[model samples]
Target chain A: MGQPAPAVLLPDMSAAGEVSLESLRGKVVYVDFWASWCGPCRISFPILEQLRNELGPEGFEVLAINVDEVEADARQFLADVTVSYPVVRDANGTTPLAFGVMGMPTGYLVDRTGVVRVIHQGFRKSDGEPLRASIVELLGE
Target chain B: MKTLTSLLMAVVLCGCETVQPWERGILAKEEMQWQTNVSEAQLRNQIYASKEASSGGAGASGGGCGCN
Candidate 1:
């Protein structure tokens, strides 16, 4: 999309802290908006974890935004499928509005410079390959 | 007359509100589904289909057999 990703500042779901998009400016970031009830997200999480693990040392980062109104639901979902990436909670939901997210499990590939290069809506098993390729290309830059 | 119709349409459209993507979690809840219980829905659908000799469409069309 070639648009600068909107600034996201939200509480980290894991620890007693917060995470922001600005902090990850130097890395190729995957900004994913997800909810516990989103079916595609269950599929997307593992693949995202795989990408993060494989490409992390190369400066690839995943910043997941959980949009669940009930934090417990998200925690339960995460308990079933865990990821090492920094997962933040946007309980107020202002972040998704800033991103103009139109569907669940939306992903924005933010290159090192903070501009969103790709917008992926809904995920399938086949999408992992292309998403990986995009991140790899961005990291190569 | 056209101005009055346009005004009416605008008034009606004003009642419509867009539910943002993230807010759809409530809609995705199990209680919000048309049939909250999958097994119960399946059983009801089976009975209805057997009685009417039709299935699917949620009452959109009759069966080809014209039994209805």
Candidate 2:
């Protein structure tokens, strides 16, 4: 729960500019690397949305990066499950390489100080329990 | 003949090394998958199999047309 997280700055999918994990400093960040083709990612999308809405007042932010070669695929998925959290695209997948993301729905929970507290590999409906505990613990810290 | 024998031996030895959990980061990449682009590849393979009347390795069972 104390390793420094790698730097990640990617083009914003919802806007015309770039957004960096650096901007989310001082806030607990849930950095999720996902792709449209991954089935597990479909499960995590709504969980992240609920968490972001619930913990946003406690300075929690979700930075979801989509690594789809075709942006339309991501958009289609978003149409099914929409999220208000900041969404970004890493078409070249360069950011995930730095984070050592080996799977489709890998997530890094960064504390307010920008230290990685957890690396969750997959997503399940029941996973939100422990994930919330970790987020709550960090929020308490 | 010796080179061919060694090549066969190497092929047999490929699966001997078990990848450790910590060393699986590279092994987990999307591109490292057998089907790097599964959806697209699946559709393409299906179309090819249907057209050619020969289909295998598509993972799904063949349809009534005998396509893979």
Candidate 3:
């Protein structure tokens, strides 16, 4: 068994609407904590989009949680990226603190059983390979 | 005064040792001092924020501030 996912309620994606960890049960979820002003975040965003498209229908979900303090910047970033997946906003970082996120582009992959299996600290192109492999493994491929 | 000068020269000679590029393998070990310092990481985080527009690169390493 992996680490149990901590109970936390994330903010709604300002561009879309509300979403929560509890609502995403029964799927392998990749939770990415980012902001509009982080460079590594910008680079990893596309990879995340690709993962969502490639593995999404196979029960993999990407939750891009924005740590931007302002709603305007978050909205502008959404327009900038054109991301299709939900981008939740952490207006006060309550959820971020609960998740122990240390830096931008940090990712946590929780299995369908709600056990967090992988915790990635940064975004190097090298980081994505392991992440993808873990997702594929969890999805039973 | 001459003894002091000799002692100082000896210390300087001992301090002159340098590590060549290949010798850096030991320094590159994880336990070495080259690990990312928290303050330096914050400075780089600001650079990252300015260049990429994102935050939260390492867990609990950042708190929301105008710094990034």
Provide the global lDDT of candidate 1 against the true structure: 0.91
Give the range of the ten consecutive residues with the poorest summed lDDT in model 2 chain B. B18-27
lDDT of 3 by residue, A1-141 (tens): 267777656556654457888788899998888776666777888888888899999999988877775667667878888878777776666666777776666789989988889888778766667788899999993
Best-first order by lDDT: 1, 2, 3
Q: Which stretches of candidate 3 lie over 4 Å from their true place?
A: A14-17, B1-68
lDDT digits (tens) for residues B16-52 of candidate 1: 9888888888888878998788999867766777676
TM-score of each: 0.84, 0.68, 0.63
**For residues B1-68, could you state the per-residue lDDT of candidate 2 as single tens digits?**
99999999999998698542223434556878887887998687777778767565455566636443
- 2 or 3, which is superior by lDDT? 2
Q: What TM-score does structure 3 among the candidates reach?
A: 0.63
Pairs in steric clash, model 2: none
Q: Model 3: per-residue lDDT, tens digit, B4-60?
A: 999999998998874422123235334776545868867876776656544575543
Interface RMSD of each: 0.8, 7.7, 15.6
TM-score of chain B of each: 0.59, 0.48, 0.43
Restricting to chain A, the TM-score for each candidate equals 0.98, 0.96, 0.90
lDDT of 2 by residue, A70-105 (tens): 789788888888899989988776777778886668
Higher-scoring candidate on DockQ, 1 or 2: 1
State each model's C-alpha RMSD to the native: 4.0, 8.8, 17.4
